[model samples]
Every structure is written in C-alpha cells, then in structure tokens.
Target chain A: MNNNILEDLELFNEIIKEFLNEEKTTPASKFISPENIMKEIDLKLDKHPLDNEKYKKLLKQLINSTPKSSSKHFFNQLYGGRHSKAVLGDLLAVILNTSMATFKIAGPQVIVEKTILETISNLVGYSNESGGTFPTGGSMSNFMSVVMARDKIDLSINKRGMSKTLIAYTSDCSHYSIAKNASFAGIGRENVRYILSNNRGQIDIISLEKEIKKDIDRGLTPFYLNATAGTTVLGAFDPVKKLVNICKRYKIWLHLDGAFGGSVIFSKNLKNLVEGIENVDSFCFNAHKTLGAPLSTSVLLVKKKKYLYKSFDNDAQYLYQTHNKDY
Target chain B: MNNNILEDLELFNEIIKEFLNEEKTTPASKFISPENIMKEIDLKLDKHPLDNEKYKKLLKQLINSTPKSSSKHFFNQLYGGRHSKAVLGDLLAVILNTSMATFKIAGPQVIVEKTILETISNLVGYSNESGGTFPTGGSMSNFMSVVMARDKIDLSINKRGMSKTLIAYTSDCSHYSIAKNASFAGIGRENVRYILSNNRGQIDIISLEKEIKKDIDRGLTPFYLNATAGTTVLGAFDPVKKLVNICKRYKIWLHLDGAFGGSVIFSKNLKNLVEGIENVDSFCFNAHKTLGAPLSTSVLLVKKKKYLYKSFDNDAQYLYQTHNKDY
Candidate 1:
C-alpha cells in the first residue's frame, strides 16, 4: 500500500522476469555454484547484502535445496506420489486453521474427512455405525486401530490399569509400527507376540492361533491382532477374512493395517485383496498414497463407534467436556 | 471449456460459496447431529440413485466434502493446521504424480523438499553432516531414530539378529510412540526401561544414569536414550544438554523428540529450551504441527548422515535401484 512497497513490487516483477528469461536460456539447475548464481542474479537485481530481507535472498533459498524429497529425486519410503488438488485442499485447510476436535472449527474438512471415511467404509463394507478420523498417516492409523483393539477387548484396562501380562498378535512380515503402537498404548512390548508369516508375507493364521493359545497357556490375556493389508517391505496382504474368523472365535479385537493398500478399495481389481476387512473391528488407509491426497491424509474407519472413545477420550476440563462456555 | 462445463462450474462455485457462508453461521460445540448434517447435504447435492459411473460419483463426492478443518471447531491433536500454499504445492505434486525417490520423476519437489530440509538443518545448527527426511509423522520419525541407533551402535545386530538383552531409555512422561518405536525396531518393550520423572516432568537424569549403570553392570547393551521435548500429556521438555553428555560419555545414541516443539527454533524465546540439541545423534520434529504444514510432514535430522542409510536404506532393486539412475 505504501510507495516503497509499490516500488519493491515493480522491481520484483522485473527481476523475476529477468531470472525467468535466463532460466529459459539455461535451466536454473545447470548453474551449480552459489556465487555464480548470485552474481548472475545480481546483474538483474540490485545486489545489497545490507538488504537482508529482500525477495532475492528468499528466491535464492527457494532454489538450492538438496535431497529434494518433493522433487521426484528423493524416494526413501512409500506414498511418494504427491497430489496437487489434495495439496490445494491442505492449503485451504491451513488458512482455515480449524481443528477437528469439535463440531465447529473444522466445518468443511470435518464433512470432507467424514465423507471420505464413509466412502472408504462403503468400500470396506462397514455398517452405519462405522466411523473414522484423519490421522497424520498410516502409522498413526495403525496406532489408533491397536488402541481401539486394546480398549474393546480389555475395557477395564484404562481404569483398573494395564494388565502387564496381556498379549497381542500380528504377523512377522507385517509393519513394525504395530509393536511400537502396543508399547506406547501401555501394553508394553513384552505383551505383543509376533506370529510367524508364510513365504508370501501373509499372516499364517495357524501360527497366529497357536500363539494366542500359547500365550493363554502361559497365563497372559490375549487381546488384539493387527492384520496388514500391505507390508512395507513386500506388498503383502494378510488373510484378513481368515484372521477375522479366528479373532471372532477367540473374542480378540481385530483391525486391519491397510495403510498402503487400503486404497485398493478404489480399484475394483484390488478390492478383493482386502476380502475380510468387513469382519475387522476397524480399518484404515492413507489417501496421500493410492487415494491421491497430500501426505498426512490418512483415515481410520471403525466398525463399532464406541471403541474410538475408549482409545482417545482425554477428559481435559478445558476441552472435550460439554461445559465449555466458549463452546 | 464448453457451455455444459461452464454451467457445472458455476453451480459448483455457487454451492461452495453458499457452503462457506452457511459455515460462518454455525455455533461452535452446539453438537450438530452427524445424521442431520449428512441429511442436509444430501438434500443440497440431491444425489440421484440412478446416477452411475465412477468419475461423476467422485465429483459428487468433491461437492459433498467438508472444505475447512478449522471451520468445524476441530482441534483434537497438535498438527491439524492445514497450510494453503503448502497444500497448493501438494496438489500440483499429486497431479504431476512424481516419485520423489529420484530427480527424474520429482525434480521440482525434490528440490523443494531438499530446500525445506536445509532450512530445518540451519535451524537445528547442523552445518555439514546434518541430514533429514519427510517421514509420515512423529511415530515414524521415532521409529527411524531407533533404527539409526540400533545400526550405529551394533551393526551385527541387523545382519545376525536382535538380541533380547538390548535396552533403550526414555522418561515415564515421554510420548507413547517412543515405546512403540523401540518395540517395532525389535528391542521389545521389556528392553525399553522407563526412567522416573521429576515434579516439573523432566526426565530424571540421575535416575537415567543409574539405570544405564545397572543395565551395563548386568551385561545388557544400552543402545538408545531418547530425550523428549514437548512431551504429550504435560508438554514437558527433557534436559537435552545433560542427556547428550551422558549419552556421549557412555557411547549411547541420543535422540531428541521435538516433533511437537522443534519449531520453537523460530522463536527466540523457546530456542534455548533445547540448548544441547546439536550434541544428540538425531533430532526430529513435525512441520505439520508448529510449522503449519499438513499432517505427516515430519523431519528427522541426524548428526551423522551415514546413519540414515543404516536405518532406511532397505530399498530393494525394483522400487528404488532403478530410480537411482535418474539423478
């Protein structure tokens, strides 16, 4: 709005145009040396190190980043394909800066996240009672699924205290996240039993069943099982239907770690991969992955509604309670 | 592009505007029934049972999505703020669908993410060997740090196998995710010893020293000691400088979990809270939290760059090796 700001904007436009022209002549990345690039840029814009807050300094910073995770050059993990539309939604989201913890601040994102979860639920064949939340990613989703399992099967654990002797099961080939989830949720890693896996990376239901029995024989309470839809090392799908049957019979809480492949529901061809998902207590996947959202758009859909509360219901006086005057 | 398309665009624009306007009218914490909200949207969108086809159905979905996370009165977790510019970048990222594993697929994003990492490095005061990556969230960041510690302290453990005698240390007030990380990384929860916390909720350093001595006396391998910054429940900060010294003297890998408070680097007031962060083998934080990036934009910066490969260099021939040729 000021004359100085107007002058700066005009100068900025000219310098940007000059840089674009030079880049068109020789791709910006070709000029490797920081000094050379700086010198070249200086010819277009007035170089004054004294003006530390100038746009050129910021522009220089915008150019020289290494490792380049977003640049297609930095592929270290799964879910690398970034989504522009999803990114836009996230941009809109941050500007809005609303939390999903309540009914109002998260107006549209709440509906969007909820609807997306519902879409996923329909794909997974959950009933009207099924619901979910947009956690940071698949890892957090798995964490929630584990907590839900622990809470449902051992409802008294939170109040009476964790049964240190309790045990849970997942396949050897499944993600290592589940073990961590159990440890964090107060189950202690000692209680989490790893069931052996088949050569194809599927959970050996027989082995899992035997482990549960063995743990019970050892006088440990058996509570939960996490069936992976796809393992990180190998794209492995667990025998979800078979695993669910065993859990149902044994009264263990069953949930699916479908973060990588849960989006397979979108592909009719891949839908069969998660056949027993409908039978599980909960399921989750990353939209940032196969579903094409920005990183962190992960969802956890539950078959039973009450379990989510059992896991994350922090009854702080300032929040969650219905008595807040601001609310 | 066409009159039909134009008409549809107008309808979409009108609908989104109306939705935004209506959103401003809603009261926070009034407890709007999910069913009633869903019904109202259904009335607005008027989904015809007869409509068929995947693409159109997905369009209907876009129309129905909750647009803003903040507008819904949601704030359950730490990193719900969805940034607009970053989201725009993300959408462009998804549409282009570049694999960041290599420069050939994700040239621009790789450049962008690399720059982002560098900015983080400068903040943490790591000049040369400092390195990091954008993992899913705090849990994975913790998981990777554990993996790095395990590989750095004991290489044979990876090739030979995990020893039951190995142990890790964190405060009783630390995030649940840390215990999970230890267990998932194969140390087992039994090996993760929880140190007692003082009244202000800092990790008891004297107790930590005692436990490490006890573990060493018993011939157990004490590999990792995690000092948390911004603990979950109490938002507590550990004494990083002391922990770093102890870790250095005992040859233990020290990690700082600043996933929540790492962004305090930008604040002159809070930066000193993590005074000795540079001495630790690794440190991690989520930009999605304090930096306002969408979920899962977590960065794990390590003191020794080589440790990064030791932890996550598990990429096989098909998925990663081929992409290596691009850069």
Candidate 2:
C-alpha cells in the first residue's frame, strides 16, 4: 500500500478502536441537537483538502457527535445492531467497489447476489421460476412492486399513460411507502384504498374485500393489495393466507412488505407469519433491518421472474455488451 | 473490542494487504467468463455457519475470483479508483449506520448531507431557496426528476391518475434510464419523445423544438425536457443554454442528467460545459462516477426546494416523531 492508503488505514484502525471502547463504556453517544450541530462539530467542506492529522481529527469528532446506530443501546428505528460477519462483508464490498450492473464487470459478485436472492426465494417457498433483484431500499422495492402490478394489470400502461383508474388496497397500518409508491406509479395516492386495520393492527380481510368490490363496482381496476409481514408500529403480521384468495378472486396482485419483520422467514418457528408468501405476486424485505446487515440492504422477489423483466427491462447497446443467456 | 471483531478486523487487514499487493503486480485480475464462474468460485450459502478459519479461507477465495474494480486497469464503467478519503468516509458510514430519514436519528449526518447539497446548489448558481437530496443512484435521481416534473405540470396527477397525455423529451444519446424512469413515473415509455442527437451526439435543438410543437399541436402536454451532460456511448454534452428558451416557452421542467460528467462543475475550465445549469428546474449527478466515491452516490438538486416535499412528502406518525421545521 502507498503512504496515503497506509496512513488512512492506520487512522481507521485508531478511530474504530476508540469507537469500540466508547460503545463498551457508554453504549450510546452524546446526542447533539439538530440546531446545535454546527457549533458542536466542524462540518465544512473547504476548497483545500485538510492535512491527514486534521482530517482524522475532524472525522473522529463528527463520528463522536453522530448517533451510534450500531451500539446496543441505540434503538430508534427498526434496525440496530451490526453483525460482525455483515460488517466484514460491507468492508469488503467497499474495497471491491464493484457495480453489479452486468456480469462482465461484477463477475462472481453477481453470483453472490444471485445466490442470496435464490436462497430467499427458496425460503419463501417459491418455484424454480421465481427470481429477484436487490433494490436500493424498502421504499424502492415497494415502488418496483407497484409498477410491476400496474404493468401486469395493463401492459399498455407501460407504453401509454394510465387511462383506467387503477385502485390498490392496503391497510392503514402498512408502511407509508405504499401511498408514495402509488403516486410514483401514476395510480395516484387517492386511488390507494387504505383498508381499516383491526385492533391488533392487522389488515381486516373483510374491509380489504369490501374495498376491492367497491372499486370494481365503480368500474375501476383493482390491481394491487399490499399486506404487511410486520406492520410499523404494532409489529403485527397481516393475514397473508386469508388475503391470497381475495387477490386471486379479484385478480389483484398481492405483495408482502416485510421491511420491518420479513426476516421471520429465517426462523422455523416464525416463518408461519408469512404462510402464504409463495402465493403472493411479489415480496420484499430489508436485510439491513432484521438480518443485522448494514443500512439499505433490501431484496425484492417475484413469484414469476418474467414480471421483473417485463416491467424493468430496457436495452442499451453500450452497457450490455455481453450476450450471456443466463443474465 | 471483542475477540470476534478483532479477529475479523485482522482478517480484513490481511485480505486488503494481499489485494493491494496483487493490484500492484497485476492491475487487472484474470477475467473469468460467465459460464466458468460457478466452477471457479464456491458461492453456496450453507445453512450452518462456517468455522472462522474456513470462513476466512472462503472469503479470500471469493475475493480472489472477483473483479478488481478499484484497480487502475479496471475501466468497464464510468467509475473506478478508490480515493483514500472516500474509502475512509464509506467505512465510517458503515460503522455509524445511521439512517437519514429524520433529524432525531441522523443528527449531524443530515447536516453533512445538507451541506454537500447546498455546496453543489451554490456551484450550479441556484439561489438560497434551492435544495437537494441524496438518492440511491443515478437512475433513481433521474426517476425523481421525472416524477417531480410530472407533478409540477399537473399537481392533480398525484391525486388523480393521468387524464392528460403528458410528453417528455430527451436526447437519444442520453442514459437508458430516461425511458425506464418515464415508465416508472407513469408517463409511459412511448410517451418519451427521443429527440435525435446531432453527429456529435448532442441533442438536436431544432428537433427538440419540433417535437414539443408537434406534441402541443396534438393536444399533448409537454411536461419535461431532459438534457444530457456526457451521454453514455459518446461523452457529449447537450446545449443547456439553448434549451432554456424552449422550455420556458413550453412551460416545461428542464432536468440535467450529469450522471456521467457533472463533476466538471468543480473544474474552472470544464464548468462551461454545463453553463446554464442554474436555469434548470432540476439537476442530478453521480458522485460515484467522476468524483470517485463508492458506488451508488447520487445527488439530485432542485431550484425550488418546496417541489421536493410537494411530490414526495407523506406522513407516517411512527417514523417521523420529531416535528423539526428544517427537516
């Protein structure tokens, strides 16, 4: 390694040592209020680069003030602790810095991603035809599901803008991404029928069916139904098995948002929460949340792989030079 | 630090040392063909965890078989070379692992992101009211621009599905994401008017105007015009200043996709390539490209900050607990 990389690596090791010691003693770092952040630490990006010592000092100070999400005491959201293996994987990924766009560039890294997706598919009881890809995060995975559902219902929607009012059903307890994704997919936020959730925070099957029927009666296309594997607040799992029939009868695509609790599939005792996962048109989960990976590790799986290509496949001559059949 | 962490860190140092040594001797590693990838690397994910020694061995094997994206000889895409400072930043981010959703959780990290956005906005000559956010990648930044443009022209599209035939124009030489983003935004891929590029690969100004006029004559709403800075196949820059009048006349939102070459804003000489960047309604670029940050670092800036919230803001009581006005 060159002198620059060696110096940076030494700085990294020193900082990590300090961080680990702090975590052991305090667990949670001192929280700096948003208003006082500028006074607490120097966060400026100057035209001239800082010297190695100054840069290291500034980085350590900034890190000291920032929230310790990986610490045991930090529990603000759905994700917290960092698995050692996962951290190792992330460090390696940063060092590799490969773009997984094509096989030619990514090589075996593509196989690694594919294997993880396939393993998840198998866990969900999906068929050999099932396949998936890693989106940026839960919101994007939800967005992709909405777009695929729209295209499946009306293939012409991909070619021509929406002419029919496509209605989607989701419980009020579901992730907020559902409504946002609806708007993104051009279905309109108002078109998403927020079904009433039971006291337990699960989607009421009757309410979902009622909303679907009402939309159909209004001559609107009931295209998608989003069921939560684990709701945001109550950590409630929607009745996935019960909604399967409703989706089948109404011809609406069913998607399971396992952003908060989808990692339950990894557990033999808890996999029953998503009992009808195989029957759902699509499913997504954040490994970063329950699997203790780094932030933004989301995977989206489809029952039939063709829908993924149908919705997202766009050709560019320059990017895809390889003519591999598997990819 | 725990024994596990120490062991992993030691292993990481060892692997990185080997990687650097290999990079020096052979800048580009051997390229394994797609068909031979499986035979070359053992990528199976077993149910039980491998022993520490076995795990380290497997990891090294996997790393050896993978492509050396950070090496000097690896130049498959728009990005390469790992800047020591950027690598340090990414490592710190992984350790912190804080989500930038709200001020309470992210704290100074939010300010850091905001500062970068503000600096970029100022560089583009945007006013104090201008702001931006970090999306997942270039494709997503482009997608957000499309959605915002669609909502800006007709706000009702967010509430009611598209009743109007909205048209978008982009150069044929632009990134392939334009058509895909159009489909995602509900404008339909066919609705994207692919204006022919001149012999130099820049968007033909006359053809763009002609398409806009033709669409207007057909009672279609021309909502967005995407100008490219450093197109995919040929590193061509579209005439940003010339398109300003056309977009103004049509009342269309102009977005600059600088995914491949927006870093020129930092160069005194090359800044003239994107001369009228200040007039654009929205602008985006991938820091991972020319800036040499890690993969998937994209920034999207908007001239008017309110339009971001207008298009993407949705409330969830559980996630956004703090009522900070700045966030």
Candidate 3:
C-alpha cells in the first residue's frame, strides 16, 4: 500500500475516536475505579485539563459518586437540611430558570416572591405598602439598610455622585458585616461609630445620641442607625423604643438585622422582644434560621414598598425587559 | 353564676377557638378534626405560657400537619427552596446549633464552611491565600467588595470617614443593589457612577477608564469598580480582562459580582466568560441562584484574605467568649 493511503486510514481512526470521546467526556473529571475507561489525567501533577480518555471517565465517575449535597444529611450550613414541599419548587425553578428583576419573566416565582414577602411584611405588622425582596441572608438584609439610608440622604448617589459625609450606627455587638458594610459604602469604618451597648448586648441609646451629636459637631453627616433584633453573639434584643425615638429625632433611617430571631414573630409570647419594631424603616429575618426553612432564606422588608425602589430600583434590560413593556 | 366566673369560662371557650384556626394551626388537621373536637388553640390571646392542654395538642398537630418544603412543589424564594439533604443537616445543626466563626464554637460547621469556601475559592482559581465567608446575598457580597476596596485605598477610611468625592463604577446593566450598597457605605449614591453598557450589556470599558481619569482630574478619589457577571440584564458579562488591567494601572479595587454567574465555575463551557476573573480583588456568588440550594445559601470571597480581616476583623465578647477551659 502507498504511504499516503496508510496515513489517510490512520486519520480516519483518529476522527472516529474524537467523535466518540467528544460526545462522552466532560472537560474535567476524577474516577475512583482503576479499570473504568477513565480519562488519562495525572492526578499527582497534572491538575490541568487534558484529553486523556481513561482519566476523564474515572474523574466523571468519582464526581458522580461523591456524596450528594442535596440528598446526603450534611446540613452543617445555615440553609437546607431536609427539604419538603420546597424541594419540588426548587426543582421546578431549575427546569424554568428565571430572574427576579421582573414579574413577567419569573411568572409564578414572582407571585410566590410577593406572597412570601407579603406574609413576612404582615408578620412585622407593616401596612400594604410594605415590601422587600428575598435577599440571600441576614448580613445582606443589614446591607439593604445602609442602601436605603444612603438613598434618603441623596438620590443622586444613584446618578451624579455622593455629596455628604454619610454615617451609619450599629451596636458594638452588631455583626461584623455592619462595619464591613460601612466600608463598602465608602463610609470608612471610623464613620460607622459604634455605640456602647447595655449588659444584655442591646444598644446603649445615650451613647448613640452623644455620638450623633459629636458627628454633627464635627461636621460629619449622620444618616442611618441599625438596631439588632437578635445579634449573632448572644441572642440579645435592643431596646427598640429608645432607638426608634432617637432615629425619629434625627430623622435617620432605622434598620433591623433580625436574621436569627426575626422568626420569633411566629410566636406570640416572643413578639415583645422586638417591641416598637413598626417604627423602623425596614426589618428582615432569616426564615432558614429559626423557621426551619432551607438556607439562604433571609427576608428584608420595609414599612413601605417605596423604600426598596428608592434603595435598589435599577432596571437592567433582558432581566427587566418584561417589567418595562407598556400595558 | 358569678359575673367574673361567667367571663372566665367564656374567655376559655374563645381561646380554644383561637388555637384551632387554620391560619394559626400547626401539627395539622390530619391528626384531629375540629368536628371531633381534636383541633383547637388558646381561648385567650394573652394567656400566659399558653394553656397546656391546647398547647400540647398544637405541638402535636404542628409536627404532623407541618408540610415538608423538601417534599412539595413550592418555589417562592431562595431560602425556602432548600434540598432535603441540606435540610436534615440544618436540623442537626439546630439540635446542636453552633456558630462557624471559629473552629472552637463551630467544629464541623466551621469545617464545612471552610471546605465549601475552599471548593468555591478553587473554582475561581484563587491562590492559597484567597479567603472568604458565607455572607447573606449579592448585596452584602457587593458591599464587602466596596469595603475591601475602600480600605485598600486608604485604611484611614476605617477611622476617618467615606471620602465624599470618591468614585466607583458599576454598569447600568448591573443590579440596583450596587448603587444602594454604595449609598449604605457612606458614599452617597452620588458617588456611584452607573456606566452604561453596549448592546450586549457589558460595561463599556472605554467609558470606565475615561471616568476614572476624569474623577482623578476633578480631585475626586476613584477607587472601586464593580463588574457584574450574569447581569440582572441580559446575563451579560463585563470585559473583565480589560477592566482588571485598568484597575491595575489605576490601583483601583476591582470587584466581580458573580452572584448569578459564578456557578459557571462548575461548567467549563461557561467558565471562560469570567476568564480574567482571578484579576479581581474580590468575588461573590449565590449558590441558591443556580445550585438549586435553599435561599440564604450565598457567599463572599476575597482573593487576598487580608482584605477581609482588614475591613471586618472585629473583637467581641459573647461570640468571642473567653477561651473555653477543659471542664
């Protein structure tokens, strides 16, 4: 046979193998069985993607056989443990992946979101205008508080740029996320101005007032105050009455980080812990924390739905196109 | 009968009806129907400690009637859409509730958090020094990025205050939360510059570079850039490579809000969109968004671990309890 003919036949075999492999193997994998036609990846040194067949199969099998995060009883995190009716909803969401930026795209998810938000808003004794989105956690809920406060000070932050030395206040016992939030707002951690707390870990209102006065004296702007519903450290509640009064006096935005204890709203006896909560601008709780829901179920609600729009009302196309269409 | 005695007895009857209502009912109607006098609540709203007979019945009914979210088809929000496996683990977490802030208090939760974080860090191709925490959502995640950026610019922000003239950039295609985040951090929304994007919705890098320089020339501090992946808009990805270089040149902190798109780290085909992701100073994603996990399953990670500590490292009592002594 001519050398050219032999080379052509070899090329045919290569193409056949390529077709078969491409249809079977994923880009990455790790197989446990020694003889399972896996991709030929060098586990010891080759941590990179390769074209080895045996190695690929082996990797795929390994990954497939790894403990299932959804099925295995490994609920060490703050979210899911044993899903119930909610899992059905979760799977349905996957088959119909959609965003929450609009009502039309999300369809039922939108209704569900609104209903859930309404249920929570009602629990907080908010009026019809009260509403919020499903943030990922308590920390993010707190983050929402800052956003609202910022908006109240200057709507242009969403447009032109910042103009004031905006300030935020939280108890020393507050989550570390608060100071982190302050930094994120470009407020510099120093501007967060921690207020000393009572023995029970609740905010010390006197210190808060003095500090706000000091900031005013120093010409630093003050705009928001965060009150803890149930801080992470000790399940402590701030004296909501005093804080509300101070916020009212200064016309500051009030936010409650009720991630863990917010669900206490469900128990009549426990409701008093968050007394005077209605006076605040916004509140949120982690349904996953005490309500026995899955993880990542933190709800951020405002006394008025308008505040959410005021804080986070950007309308990006594709996600919000349906929301933008005229009637 | 005496007037007081008649009132007490009448009150008792009302309380029983209150506990039996469908809205207030738990355990469930499956065990006992009201027709059979099986379902009931308290006779009074102010009853102390609740009536034992009715309370136990309610508990029993709650445990039984309690619909399982894992089993049903309910997809309202991120947290409730929990998986059964994650739920079981979460229940166990509650039976043995522990915090994950450190190894001592958290033990396994900490390990799990660390493992999950490591897996995510590896997916983003971060170096060994990369670090992060399981935050609440995209908002807090964005906020963390801002905080880290602020501190990196001038740690003095931690003590001084947000520089009112500071400039940060996010796309018009981005989430409204970014602007809110900027507002909350003390830099009023005025400081948040929403750069419009192209037809595909990617941040216009040319405009971004121009703005940074313009801000500097105008005596404004230009320090942070927020690039969205899987934008709330058309699932657009920012020009990460170009932005990373500009950030490098200008010494600005670059944050990639990959809340919806970060999950692509598990998919090779989609991963390239975030190609130059490693160049960003911080990254965040929502597992609940694409991973089919329950809500509140969100995270925030930093390429440089020091940034997390620099911005949020805090000391407190209850959470930082006196080191445990061998009992």
Query: What's the DockQ of model 2?
Result: 0.70
Positional deviation of A168 in candidate 1, in angstroms? 15
The DockQ values of the predictions, listed in order, are 0.11, 0.70, 0.13
Report the C-alpha displacement of residue B206, candidate 1, in angstroms: 2.5
Clash list (residue pairs), candidate 2:
none
Model 3 scores a TM of 0.62
Q: For candidate 3, lDDT tens digit of each residue in B3-122?
A: 222233233334323432432333222322223222242222232455546654543443233222222243333323434333323323322323445543333334346656777788
Return whichever of 1 and 3 wins on DockQ. Answer: 3
Docking class for candidate 2: medium
lDDT by residue for model 2 (A148-172), tens: 9999998888988788889988999
lDDT of 3: 0.63
Worst 10 contiguous positions by lDDT, candidate 3 chain A: A1-10
Task: Give the per-residue lDDT digits (tens) of candidate 1, residues B1-327.
Answer: 122322432343344445446556752333444556655444232233424244344544433354344343444547444444444334233323344556543544455566667766777888788778877668788888887787677665554334345678999887777655554444656678899999888999999999999999999888899888887667789989989889988999999999887777778899999998878888988877776565447888988787887645543344444333323
Q: Which has the better DockQ: candidate 2, or candidate 3?
A: 2
Report lDDT (CA) for all predictions. 0.64, 0.86, 0.63
For residues B1-327, write the lDDT of model 2, one tens digit per residue: 233666677778899889878888878768888777778776788887777777788788888877788776777668657777788788778778888888777778889999899988989999998989988888889999999999998889998878778999999888898888888888898999999999999999999999999988999999999999988788999999999889999899999999998888989999999999899999998888887788878999999998999999888877787737786
Q: TM-score-based ranking, best first?
A: 2, 3, 1
